[model samples]
Target: MTDATALVQHLNSDFSAGHDAVPARVNGTASPAIEQALAHPDLAEPIAAALAYAVVRARGAVRVAELGTCPADRVRPLRRAVERIATERAKAEAVCGPLRRPAQRASHRLGRSLKQTPARAVLPAAHRQTLVTACAELGLHADAFSVPNQRNGAWAQSRGLFGSVPSEAVRELAARDDTEFVAALLHDARMAEDERLGHHLIVERWNRLSATALAWGPYAIANAERRAVSRPLHARRDVLDALEDAYEDLAVLTCRAGEAKYRAFRLTCQVRELTVTGKRASVAAAAHRRAHELLQVSHPEELAEIAEAVRAHQVDCPFRADGCPDCQRVVLKGLSGQCQEAPGSRPEPTSPPQPTDASGPGVTYASFGAEERYAVLNDIPGGARVVVSDAAIGEDSALCGYGWAAEDGTTGHGDSMASTSGEAEIIGVCAAALTALTTHANDEFLVLCDSRQAVDAVQEVEEHGDVTRAQEAVLFPEAGELLTRLLPYAHRITVRWLKGHIGHDLNEAAEALAGLALRQARGRIAERTAHRARARTTSRIATQYLPRRSMPHAA
Candidate 1:
């Protein structure tokens, strides 16, 4: 806020489209706060941008046509007006070397931000034109990464899609993954509204930052390459932190977008409120309850659309009561049509199996099996996954070469590479509770896991056990041969075990993030990932749960 020091002065006053807006009624007035912020320098622009993004989003394409009373036209006022701040910052830096631009340049930067650099625009409804321009600009500037043939609809729904939230649809403000939000908001809205919102939803919820954004946003490849080159854990974490921060404003923009959708479409209604933890099961129940309430509405255009969408995604037209909870979102949507029943997969026959390990001396491994519904966060597969279809294999980045699993699994042999790390596929992963030493040298290394087996070859203590163990390339195998070589030039190195999803917070977050990144990379945007984050509510009220069925668990 180079212009206003403390707060935004006249947020709603900037637009003169002649609409009746009772700002005092909808968004509470903060004149005193605005006046106070006017005196501060850093707060105005971001706030203004956030406000502007909210407006442009409210005004969707087909602006007044589809918007009707929605006033989707307002979505562009500020986006059309704001200056290209990111680019001006770049040019200013070219001359000033790290110092911010002169006040005049910044004013021009914020005055018409979208016009100058359309790629940085926050309005999802304007992504098509902006993305084409962005592609052209990147081609001229960074030919290596320019998106040439990419089309719009990554934001707006394409043909045959009912609808999805625009890239600007905000779920959480101050979210860690904001880059994808920006990418969708500024570039993909032009996507035919038919493609629906699934792709953007998945990515926006999961991957806010990407290697592409880092490489292209006001930085050079040298900086992007450094992301791969850094070894110190702190350095890597800092880089991630900076990328997450780069698009914090995107969340604010999306918040406005979600509000806009809720207002204009009126697609959802609350029939009842339920008290529950922040989990998929809880959220799904909430969605179901909302859907049921909307069904009773006299005039529910949005609810009808959702009903059709739900039927199209469900495992069966009406979900079976006794079935696996782990179901695919798309399949569930397909099955959720005009049925009036509890949602779940169709029941299948199960054959009895032998049991032994259950009575073993002790549990040797973490035992949470992979559950498809709760595939992420849980160390082991959840029961939900048991009912999932194998055909729904997601094009996740972890399945690609970018995730830690892929990196760990890489192996080199006689001019060939292979994936062999059993560690990557281990279920119920837990950490070893021990740390491995790191080195200074940035050379890549390998893990020869077979040597650990050699340690078990001889358990009894012997005088020459240590010497004999070192001779063969088996017991303490890799360590014995490479110990001396690693001591001299290494700066930082650490041997870490990825325990099966044994409830470690960081590992869970990473796995969740990786799944999200995969969806985004695969270009599926509407897959919303519901995580256990605290909700944003001005008031905290609790609810009591009542059973819908009389003998809910009776045989």
Candidate 2:
């Protein structure tokens, strides 16, 4: 059957059940108002259609709640359905004018009944302002024209009241379309009035408007504007002048609205970018290391072939023209400078490997059932007995790094582009575990980690019974890879959580190593940035001052 036919049948079934009957009687019967509205031949189809849409929408909302999380792809279609119904309602209203009293009463009763349904349950008052702001932006109000006019008119009247009484800076601010700035100004004015503070006092303590207070400005402005209308003209003028003067000073303190948060977000993106660049550099360094190892043993003819392969390998280094650090290191080892071409390739490289077991050396299998065999593996390898891992992020540089220390005096540290300290911690633990497992595959390992989250994640993975199922249960890429690699050695490896920073020698050593790694990464990034700047400056100077040769006449 067609969707419309099915919807109508569903609506009929609901109505026949007396689910929304007036007075909610036990016997099944339609409400008098509903019956009257449906009795009219002209209104019957539209009423049926509207009721059907409401039922379907309500059912969909229930299904969404049951599913716990809605897919992003489904959101657009649901929004379109809402929009279509709203458009149809608008068209009907335009043709019929305001809904008739009978139809209106029926709608009101239907709305009251729907409020009892799970789909129409009330949201918290804390989110009311947010919902209203979103509704304003989406133009979803019943009286869209009047609501916008009321908001704009309130601000315009307040601005006009100030006249030429305020400074040029204040007037400039008033003219801009920054709602947050205007809201903050109005909020400050209201606060000053409450404290009975003068305009000069407000200007003197302009910085007292904390970020937390600024956050509330958008929600407070509507009430401030409404209250302003009830005050005398003289009082309103005074508040506006105070708002203007305070803003004049506030503008000096902060050049933009939410400047602190914006700067922080921008800095985070920069750090993430640098971290990504550093990761690429690390990969290039590894490839160069491999080439050097091959060069030492290969025949003279193989040297040229190896160099050719090295030149063909791609690297994403910003300082390629000046010479990538990795390529420079290779050049010092007597390789031809043409090897630099590898780092200078124009095409994009494949994505760097994620922190996973597969990225490390392959695991060697040994029978875990025999204790003697495990002891032989440990005795022969002479690997560390205990390994402690820690992660740290630079306060000034914003670079993330991880370090691990072993009882056998083996130590390792590396930098990552992790956006958060927590992620870095997990990465550090994984790196430490992967190293230990690969170096002594048959040996028992006690991996000490400070991060509770990483330990819990490992525990959760271990409890899942099936290795494949456990791997699938983990949602994070790094954590999943770590689990996949570590689970294979679960019989011999143990991950334990330890408290951090109470002078635990191994943990402290790991922390120091992580900090050292962060500092090193920071220095490398700064050097790379300076190299890029110098290159750009040189190129610009050449373009501007270097004389262009005249082309031959086209005879």
Prediction-by-prediction clash tally: 103, 0
What are the per-model C-alpha RMSD values against the true structure? 26.8, 33.4
Q: Give lDDT tens digits, candidate 1, residues 211-258.
A: 232212212211322342233333454554443332232323343343
Q: What is the per-residue lDDT of model 2 for residues 1-555, given as tens digits with 9 covering 90 to 100?
A: 965454445544443332243112112355554454333444433443343334334333432322223465766666565455445445544544343333422322221111111111122231234334433544434221111212222332342322335445544543544444444554543443222111221221222333323333322222232233345444565444433333333322222223232233333333223321443334323332333333334334434444443354324545556433233333323333323322223555799642222213332223223212112122322333567788886431224668876655556677654434665676787788778767665666667777777666666666674434533223235445666776766666566666576555567667876776665554423435544543443344334323432211111
Cα TM-score of candidate 2: 0.27
Give, for candidate 1, the lowest lDDT window spanning 10 residues.
384-393
Name the runs in model 2 displaced over 4 angstroms. 1-384, 394-399, 465-479, 524-555
Name the Cα RMSD for model 2. 33.4
Top candidate when judged by lDDT against the true structure: 2
lDDT of each model, Cα atoms only? 0.27, 0.43
